[model samples]
Target: MVSRELIARHCICCGGGNLEKSPAVLMPFVALRVFGHEPVEITEDWGLRDLRQGMAYTLCNSLQCQNCGALFLDYRFTDEQMEALYRNYRDELYNEQRIRFEPGYANVPPHYHQRANYLCEVEAWLAPYLPEAPAVLDFGGDSGINSLFREHNQLLHIHDISGVELVPGAERADLERIRQCHYDLVTCSQVLEHVPYPLDFVKQMLPALGTGSLIYVEVPHEALLRAHPGSLQLATCKRHWHEHVNFFTESSMRVLLESLGLVVVDVLHLPVDIGWTQGEVMGLLARQA
Candidate 1:
């Protein structure tokens, strides 16, 4: 017997309307054959892989949330399914496998030594809002590569699905522990898109902070994607399209933030000069109101 799962009633962001499902555009994998040379790559088999086999691709349909402009799959996978996906979510698999990176990522400038430079950029951006040795909560900060406070004596905590947590001077950011006190800043980069409900993700994280606390969010500049739909599909495909269900534009992001009682301080359109992926990423700085 098939089990019945609860459906998300309205737009996860705006709570305004039903999410509309759209058709699939791109495929992440290529053909493998004995005679033809196969290119080595590391790609998570996002439910969309098998048709010949009995495995199913439940969310091949795109669920676009018109109210807040978040386009994602409408289906809410069960905890069991989610566990299966993230239980073995390895951050280093891509590196350990030495999977050939997309030409765009390897040819990108920010790819090499990006961790250090990224920290510098983040430091500069948060300088105004951050106090010396400020407490930082790195939500979904994989292996803490995006943290800038480790060098300083600042308190930095990382919470991620990846089982491994290894960042110097950084402790595990437990959700319950985070709620104990307000933090100086919160950073979530390249994470919102992965979540099924962007609003719930923010809400869960928001309680850990309070008014005057700052939140820094970075996502693919999907607004820029309007100009290149094909590239958008390919980008999502290369980035593991199944995992990234929500697509947000700048205006949509602002709407979502403002609805949550946050003030948008800044928005940035970050175009890649170097990296395994080539595209525009939007950065937003907001303060809890």
Candidate 2:
């Protein structure tokens, strides 16, 4: 059974109509043999790799959300299925065997490092007005990287669901315990879109902050919608379907945050120069009052 939150409803982007729901199913793929000359056990669960398999690849027929215009993988995972899938993720595909990244390429930036920079940028911008040594918390502080707070020379206590595997000596945290603590600022970057219930996530995190505290959320700006329909380079990702279900535009983001009684303090457009993925529009949000 699909989790209620993952149930397909309205399109998040254009809000055209109801999304056509489908069942989640798996197919088999040989990643290396099909894409390159190596052996990577690709599975239908991986989505895009199997859909756009190769030169003679056949695209997977999944439902596109009418509102958000996102072609998403069906998210009907039963609790047992989701548990089994993620329970061994690190020990399995990501860690057991070091998958060779394609050669002649720069080491792609780690997701945590990129996220840390975003926190720093927000703090740098908000520091002038905030009191010195203000308390801050990152909702998904992967490795305490954001807590280092380099730009303002301040430290932020973090609360996360898990500890950092890559960074040694990082503190382990539970979301519930962190909520009991007070903070002046809260930052949750690039995490809102992956969640099935963004509104509730924000609602829960908001109370962890004190009065006049700020909350910063960053997510993709529906850049795919802005592309000319006929442009050949318009971005498309099959693998991404499983990960990012909610796509937000500037307007939609404002609507969602503001509806939760958080004032839209500011929106920052992320630099487009770093383009390993689609959509250049990333937003930085601050909650007011």
Candidate 3:
């Protein structure tokens, strides 16, 4: 019998029940790389017992939506599981545990503290669509370190679950405050890939937008997906599931935004050089219709 949590009942992007399945593994360590890890005996110490099968690493399927071409892990993680996986969130403690599991894992924290180089280009691309001094809200933007238009924005708000300290000039906000206040632009960057339900996640931010307010969503155009463009056979290529579970295609992204009653103003594939790696980002700029 398969664990109910390991079954994807419907397409997360298009709500389609028809999906194709392929073999994939849920890495116990939750590190980025799927291969070249030091073989360590699986144990409950990693805190993924519920997801494991009698001390064996969890073997699961990758489901691809036939309707929209979105590839994602078949497993639907619970809120508690998500919290446990991201408790320290790349801090020293988190890195120590991860390094213990995969010695090849680079223990150095990826530049979460530094502002991303791509945001400058992102801000420029969005300049024409936004007000001169937009009230910006960065949902899931940790520390507001890379919030776009920071200097020019009338107000910069950071709404994140990580509980990381905000940089100077960035105000912290809760969901209720987000509902009460309207923002000219809400940026959900580099976050959709990790979420189980992208549609529901974006829907939560809808109330913050008044008419014509724009939401900028960015996700990595994962190497596998880009290499096999328009091919639904990505499940075969993506044999391991890490923090980034959902692999979005341009068609799938458009479907997600349109289903939410948002107008897709533009979809761009932007090049990025983030010190550690050079890759592409799929940026979707949408507005309340």
- lDDT tens digits, residues 99-188, model 1? 242333333434433563445565666687678878888888877866657676368888886757466688886788888867788888
Q: Could you tell me how far off, in angstroms, the CA of residue 251 lies in candidate 1 after the best superposition?
A: 1.9
**Candidate 2, 32-130: lDDT as tens digits:** 222223334556566874364433322232445543345444443344544443343344353322334333223443442454334455556667646
Q: For candidate 2, give the lDDT.
A: 0.51
The positional error of residue 54 in candidate 1, measured at the CA in angstroms, is 15
- Segments in model 3 whose C-alpha atoms lie over 4 Å from true places: 1-6, 31-56, 107-110
Q: How many residue pairs clash in each candidate?
A: 6, 8, 0
lDDT of 1 at 91: 34
TM per prediction: 0.69, 0.62, 0.88
Using TM-score as the measure, the top candidate is: 3
lDDT of 3 by residue, 12-45 (tens): 8888888888887778686223322433565667
Candidate order (TM-score) = 3, 1, 2
Model 2 ranges off by over 4 Å: 1-6, 11-92, 95-120, 146-155, 165-173, 222-242, 272-281
What are the runs in model 1 whose C-alpha is more than 4 Å off?
Answer: 1-9, 18-21, 25-59, 91-119, 223-240
